[model samples]
Target: MINPVHLRTLVEVVRLGSFAAAATRLGYTASAVSQQMSALERDTGVALFQRSARSVLPTEAAVVMTRHAAKVLTDIDTLMAAAARTHESTSQELRLGIFPSLATYVLPRILQNPAWRKLGIELRVSVAEPGQTIQGLRTGGELDVALVYQVGQSGLAWPHTVNRQWIGDDDFRVVLPAAWGIGPESKVAADHLSDMPWIMHHPGTSDATVIERLFASCNLHPRVVAYSDDFHASLEMAAAGLGAALVPELALLHRPPGVVVLDVPEIRLARNVFALLPKEQLTAQVQLFVELLADTLHKLGTTRRD
Candidate 1:
């Protein structure tokens, strides 16, 4: 009998076209992933990949197996989900991992919705960053679903066994201290703020790297005055006239009195938010919960604009 675990790894290898890529997504070492592929070939008595010094090329057999493996995996997931639901109680408890911004701005509003009460889901919420929330969705981890965001090439990856759903995009805006005399209607260019002090994310963060590259592309090399990872804190600091900060629209919903948000044509970036759920854990209730999140996120954006 072929191991389902190996099949999952095989699917990843074929989809990503390299053992190393699959390794990163599945949280395995490249060597371990290679070994799993070897084991899978042995179980099936067929050559799965053509291995070269720099690359691993999937064989015809590998592609065929992957196609079949997808269906097999889906069936296995369905079986597991059905088995688990057989013993489920009236009010199902869902372990949800979410980032701070969404939890703060979107969650409370969703909870108040009458539709949420009808879902009969008791949410066990874990508020954390995307990295932590993703970890919680892995096998043997605590969360059944995680809400995460990816900014540019942030290198965020999840296991192939996890299903991903696109929620919405949170666009970043250039915010200046009201004291700086930059108002919402000011047509600003990147060079205009090049010499100004700026509040930024700490160096070495994925978002910071993307934002830095964006600023560099726009020829805006801001002098660093402060570093803040928290969007709310960044807003507060900007309002305090510390420096200009780039904040997402979601965070701007609760903007303080002294910060002016501008739509800088030069700085265009948005974090793509998604919900990750393990295949076997996906259920009607969970899908409904994700829908509620997407709806709330849309409403939040609309409310901010209005």
Candidate 2:
């Protein structure tokens, strides 16, 4: 029987045009690739390549073997891809991921559930900034599944390799400096902030863009006092007489003594959250938890999302 490893080395060496190049691509040393070619030739009882100082050229028999070897490699890749698809369609472990805020807020309800534990889910979760999450998916380093927050209608973009489920909606409200005496019972207009200093989200972030557009709609852009990624920092700043900030109502774990949340009059532009998976790795467990998560969010009236 022919050795597939030797055949693979042969194919790589020829396709890549040299042992050195193939070795680099395959993470083998140049000496190792050369030894593999010699061993393969000895096994076949034929010299497969002619070597000179500069390069290696295939022998006539090697030419024919390379052609057939290419087909073998192609078939192997096709078989592996199909096998992966089958596995994804049949898997049971529920590996998971969620954005940091949701990790702290809504995710606990699903993760800590007594009933879900009965499903025998092999639940794994990860928390990180959105940029890190996307990077992880690309490199196969971090998550096989992810729940993320995104702005407008686009949600998160995880390459064509990922499949997404739109899970929930996230909206922000205008916050007033503390001692403004606003409560959940209070209603304030966006126009009310037209004169107040706008404590915007950290610059170069989605929140900044949304906050800018909202204030522009009110025909104003006041001096932005501070920009920070942390909502608590923004809240503290606003409370300290810095400026008004836009804070997400659901994920605000703390309200410093001086800040008040006010409903923006007729305000509606918001981000939607998503559940994501590598298109190549959506195991059955991934599907169940995502569905359960959506259900839980819906039950909590976080269900207004499509």
Cα misplacement distance, residue 41 of candidate 2 (Å): 56
TM-score of 2: 0.62
lDDT per residue (tens digit) for residues 231-264 in model 2? 7778888888788777775545556777766666
Stretches of candidate 2 off by over 4 Å are 1-95, 153-156, 181-187, 302-306
- How many pairs in model 2 have backbone atoms within 3 A of each other, for residues 3 or more apart or on separate chains, i.e. clashes? 2
Candidate of highest lDDT:
1
Give lDDT: candidate 1, residue 202: 99
- The alpha-carbon deviation from the true structure for residue 93 of candidate 1, after best TM-score superposition, in angstroms, is 1.2
Clashing pairs for model 2 are 178-258, 178-259
lDDT of each: 0.79, 0.63
TM agreement with the true structure for every prediction: 0.70, 0.62
Q: How does residue 96 of candidate 1 score in lDDT?
A: 89
